[model samples]
Target: MFQGWNALLASVWGCCLIGFTWGQLSDSPDVLRNWCLDSDYHKPQPGPEPQLFSECSPWKERSCCNATVSKLIHHNVKVWHGFQFRHCPPQVSSECLRFFRRDFCFYECSPNLGPWVEFEYARKSRQQRFRNVPLCASECEAWFHACKDDLTCVRNWGSEFDWIEGTNRCPENAKCQLIRDTYADAKDFCETVWDNDFKYTPDNEPCMVLSFDPSSGNPNDNVTEAAISRHMNSINSMLNRQRIMERSFSCRISPSIAVSRGIPKLVCDFSFREFDKMRQLKGKPKETPRQKKERKQDFSPENQHKALRVALPIFVGFWVLIGIFIYLNTRPKH
Candidate 1:
């Protein structure tokens, strides 16, 4: 009777174990089947064998088995994370916050930031200056005269007259002369008389004159009215100051003017012989007569024909040999 009781207890335990495994497999049949077929599942099959947990299951034994669980949890957490919740830390100190907030930080937080602040400031400053005092043609003329009084004014002064007229007014130290002509003539005159260090003034016509030198003492001795008039007529002929605020306004605003004029053209007289000598020393090498003749000979039709004749037979024989070998091998291998 004790043996019978022992058998019954054993059978009951075995039944319970089998029922538990069946329930587990039913709960996750796909995972279980994949686990069974998995290369790492090394238990012997087709016999009475113990069931094992899948790597994807909570009961898995190896740490590597936990990878799927970790991945799932990470994906769930990431889905809930929001971008707006991420805020930048404040960069300015508390002491500087008042001034910085009033003047600087507003720009820092902007999407595009303050890229054009300096340019805007400069434009505003210019606008304010223009509002305070405006420039006029008369003012521009006054500025011109003031420039003449200074020993250093040459091409820097405004040019308002043709070469002849300017010569009459410019200081003697300024080598003012006029040359009547077209642009080409003016260029030639400049090269001839002024050694190319000169400028041109034309109300609407061509004229040329030496550039004034301010550093030299009184130019009147060397300059003559005839020279000025002659050059002016030769080219085409033509002729033709500031303040501050009250006390600050009382200050003499410096005179300023914009002068646009053409500079002189100097003569470039180079000899062909000298140019040729330079080419001989520094230019690229030239092909020799013999090399040129040889190149022509190599490309002649007879040579091409000779080369083709030598190559054709050899190429034909190689292919014929290959074809024969293929036929012999592929013939039914009895």
Candidate 2:
């Protein structure tokens, strides 16, 4: 009876363990499953995988990156040059603006395959950045096509589409130098680079970041300009601690902007080439080659002669008047 009872307990425990294992296996996320099938479907080779996956070449014509990018572009972007700023007031702090740009790019530009996909692909390879070149190229190409129709989008592509290094073609990664903050060094001069979390902007800090919850499969679902505006406005008010710049933007989405309450003080210290591009957009048009040639021609002998002709009579009249005045003074004095 003792031997039979012990055997029965062992059998029941074995069944429960097997059932739990099966449940876990069946519960894999769709994104992870899709990535495995798409990215890792191929058989392993003896050597390292190629930096550029030529197998994905067939996907070039298919806008694979479109779904990922449009998550932000479709809603956050207004007609070409504008953003869904109904949530963000013009008086909002610059920190909120940096947050807006960073959040948009982080979600949109990130490799659609999965997180750390770039790092994984490049781990065994010498050129890590080149590991997912094909995918990167495809994303850039898709953005180029999407923005081609809008002048403001095209012009601001440097900041707007800077994820793929602002071009469809493979570009050399720019090396960035970390500026040593004198204020920081005053506390302690450490030889090792400090892991300064505070130095990072809110978008860079995941704890402070507010990402758009993209609905599954359907990029358009729950994504609207009004929704995006409402979201941004809420974030802006939370960060605008001083209340000096906490006015909300007006839009049909939210008729009255409410002041954010009890949010942690957040600072915006981020700058992008895109901001400069926007400033340039507002500034004077660039001088074209034709304009430069015309300007050069204006200084030519022929043009100089025409200008001199107009000025010679005035110059001569002024000298004559001066001479007459001198003569009159001398004669009167005599």
Candidate 3:
């Protein structure tokens, strides 16, 4: 009984699987047909074929009574009528009929049909051999104008608000302001606004800078630049004030002569002197060793004493050697 139950379950599952597979296969065409129901999706239906009849009847004449005559005069006008006539022959085949049905369905019932049928298979053939034709200057100019307008709109929208807002248009709550200022001031304002929401700076000396060129073709150029400028200036001024308040405490530098006499000072002085010399010799070539050595050297007493100690020993040794050589020469007679 368990084995029978297992068999029944297996059969039910198999049937379900088969049904699912069949549904999957059939649903594709149904879905496509439903999609074709949309008004925009148009496809042409296949046209009806014209009917043909024989001009003369078989019983009209004795000649028609002949088998060959009957065969010649039968419905041979339409090839689908089969080759019952001798003068005309039917070219119809089972394969041709199947092909025609399929071809008709594809070019008639399918969503791609209108354009395909209007252009025929030549449409696909042309697309396959498509060449990238260069646009004329006029065409490019027109496209550029359209692209420029779109880009301008996008830029305006992006600048006006954060992306959270759906519409590209600016919110009514925010008043747009414009200020013209030096590049430096403008940069300071922008930086302040970005870092600390709408702050002022010492550079808050705002100028009325035009956001868009009034002379340019943009219509939005007429919009009040002053409002934006004031907002920017206010932010800049706030930031500037904040920065000033933060730095209000004076920085004290303790007076220390010892620090002035340090290695850093020596290095700085030496570098400064060298820089001055270089400047003096500007456009002049470097001096030779002899020219450089011509400068007077100021030796301190200690340095002079050290130099004397080194030279005195060498001088005394030279004198002793000379005397010994003279004595040896004079004593040669001994």
RMSD of 1: 48.3
* Cα-based lDDT at residue 78, candidate 1: 21
lDDT of each: 0.28, 0.31, 0.30
- Of the pair 1 and 2, which is ahead by lDDT? 2
Task: Write down the TM-score of every candidate.
Answer: 0.15, 0.20, 0.14
lDDT of 3 by residue, 1-334 (tens): 3334435545665575455343122223323222221121121221121221122121122110223322332323222112111111233333323322222222112221111011113221121110111112332232223222111111122133333322233344544332122112433333232122122222223211111122342221111133234334654664443332222211102113323433244544544455445446777746756666554333667778899999999999999999999998888583
Question: Which stretch of 10 consecutive residues in model 3 shows the poorest summed lDDT?
Answer: 111-120
Candidate 3 deviant stretches above 4 angstroms: 1-298
lDDT of 2 by residue, 72-139 (tens): 44344432123232211223233433333432433223322222122223222211111111112222
Q: For candidate 1, lDDT tens digit of each residue in 1-334? A: 3234435545665575455333122223223222221112122121121121221122222112233333332333221112110011222223322221211111111111111111112221111100111112232232233222222212312222123421313334554322132112432322222122223233233221111122352121122232334433532311100000111111111111101111111101122233334446877646768999999998889988898899999999999999999999899987
Clashing residue pairs, backbone N/CA/C < 3 A, model 2: 87-233
Q: How many clashing pairs per prediction, in order?
A: 20, 1, 26
Q: Tell me the lDDT of model 1 at 106.
A: 14
- Point out where model 2 deviates above 4 Å: 1-281
By TM-score, how accurate is candidate 2? 0.20
